[model samples]
Target: MRLTIDHRTTYRFTAPQGRVVQLLRMTPRNTHDQTVAAWDINIDCDARLREHRDGFGNITTMLYAEGPLSGIEISVSGEVVTSSSSGVLHGTFEPLPAALFLRSTPATHAEPALAAFAQAATVGRAPIAALHALNAAVHERFTLVDGRPEAGLTVTAAFARETATARDLAQMFVAAARAAGFPARYVTGYCDALPNGRPTPHGWADAWVEGLGWVGFDPTLGRSPEAHHVRVAVALDAAGCSPVAGSRLGEGREWLDVEVQVSGQD
Candidate 1:
């Protein structure tokens, strides 16, 4: 299957700033069961981007822009080829030891509700079945509310409290898989939506199996990702894996708007 993705982030503020810099993790690396037939990155604004592999072996981009300017915008577009492999992952570099994934992050800490979900996913050793079951359980247990989370509230706490946004569910998926003794990570990406301009909030979780490599599971959608999913960046938590993470030097306040569109081009 061939997939195409378009992501645009725009920022408009009341006042201009002096200098701005950001870290971008928008590039998708190759792993077994997936291929990057074509990949491209572009910045409409005046900025310089440098590529570097992080400590976890995940690709990272350092973008720097300096100006006595105001608002800025950043966008990304790409395509990929994919196929099924029993949800097995293979052929990807691992920087940190597999044990590192078992540890909890700010987003996926200890919680009773999340622990129970993870136990359900581990009923069988089959990677496909475990991940599939996890996805189904997540979808049924929580509702996809339309509001963001309060500051300092991790998905683990949110699960116990029975409240979450798309990102919160994503964190829950990762935490549950890790609790099941799998090297699971959090994924940030885009999901294609209906043509009627319906809202499509994209987020998911990835698990590392010995034979396979890094397989993705979208608990919110109740399934392993197929051709329509476009992966951007992954990390131990949702905050670290954000497509754009940076700060701007300004005086007044800042406003941000993000738009993502994905399509099955094939």
Candidate 2:
């Protein structure tokens, strides 16, 4: 399948800021299962973007703009060709050892409850099967809410609510998979949505299979991803894979809006 993505993020503020800086992880890299045919990024305001690759191998863009500006927009458009790899990631350069992902971040910390849940979910299974079981268990246990969850909610917190956005669920899956002794990471990207409906950006978890390398699982969908998924950025936690993250020079209440549309062609 060939997929196209149009993602735009806009920021509006109550007062003008002196400057704004952002890190963009919106570009998709070519993998064995995915090929990037075209990609571009545009900013509505005056800014200089410097591109670099991060440790996790994600393509990062640094955006800097001097502003007495009230708003800014970042737009990303791209096309990719993807094929099913049975969830295994191959042919991409991975700079960090898989064990590095075993180290926990605050968002994915494995508390006793999470550890116990992981143990219960994967009892008597092989590593690959265990990951599949954990993925399905997470889907069965939690519901996908329509909107994003409140910011900064941890894996345990999402479990308490019994529902969360894809981002939170992916984070939970990362935490649980790590507790189960599998190195895991968070992936942010695009996926096909229902026909004629606007597609939103997606998030999922990837676990290192002893013989299979990294395999992706989407707890939100209760299955491993296939050709419909276009992977963009990956990291130990969601924040690191976020499409855009930034800070402003001036202090004022800011409102954010994001729009994403993903379509596919045979």
Candidate 3:
């Protein structure tokens, strides 16, 4: 499948600022199951973009801009060809040991309730089957929301809620997987399964199975990622692989808006 993506993010500040700096993990890399055919990032204002790879091997870009400005926009367009990998990752960069992913971040801390739930969901099952059962359990337990996830929402809080965004679900999955004695990590990227588009990028979780290496599971979709999924960045939690993370030397308040479209063809 060939997929095309258009993503734009805009920020409006209540007061003028002096400077802005951002770290972006918006670019996808080539893996055995996926190939980047073309990609570009455009800034609406004058900014300097330096490209580098992060500790997780994600393609990252640093943007620095002089600002007395009220707003700025970041636009990304790309094309990628992907093949069905049955959710098992192949030929992808892995700098750190898989055990590192077992470490929990603030957002993915598994509280007692979540840990117990994981234990109950996967009990008496094999490793691979147990992961599938856990994924299905998560999907059945929460209603999936389609919009921006609440900032700084933790897995414990999201698990208590009746509904969850993709990010929240992914974080919850990571927490549960870790609690279940499986090394897991958060993933941020694109999926072309939506009818039109989404306000933000997609998210999922990957777990390290004994014989499978790293396998992708999307609790949001209750299935393993297929050809429609474009894998980008992976980290201990969403914040680590967040598409944009930065600070602006400004005052007052700021408003943000995001738009993402992903279309695929065979």
TM-score for each predicted model, relative to the true structure:
0.86, 0.97, 0.97
**TM-score-superior candidate, 1 or 2:** 2
lDDT by candidate, in order shown: 0.73, 0.89, 0.92
> After aligning candidate 3 to the native by TM-score, how far in Å is the CA of 207 from where it should be?
0.2
Q: Cα deviation of 254 in candidate 3 (Å)?
A: 1.1
Per-residue accuracy of model 1 over 1-266 as CA lDDT, tens digit each: 67777777777767887778888788888766457777667766688889988776768888787866577877777777766654445566667777678888866885776787678666855876787788788877886675444556687577875656777777888888888888888777766632243444377888877666677777767777766666667678888787778778888788777776676765
Q: Indicate which candidate wins on lDDT.
A: 3
Residue 97, model 1: Cα distance from true site in angstroms: 2.6
Candidate 3 shows a clash count of 0
Clashing pairs in 1: 89-212, 89-213, 90-213
For model 3, what is the C-alpha lDDT against the true structure? 0.92
CA shift of 46, model 1, Å: 2.1
**Local error of candidate 1 at residue 149 (angstroms):** 6.0
lDDT of 2 at 242: 90
lDDT of 2: 0.89
State the lDDT of candidate 3 residue by residue for 150-247, as single tens digits: 99999999999999888998899999999999999999999998434354699999999988899999998899999989988999999999999989
lDDT of 2 at 52: 91
Please write out the lDDT profile of model 2 over residues 1-266, one tens digit for every residue: 99989999999989999999989999888999999999999999899999999999999999999999899998999999999988888887799999999989988898899889999999899999999999999888876776655788888777778667888888999999999999999999999853243466789989999878999999988899999999999999998789888999998899998899888887
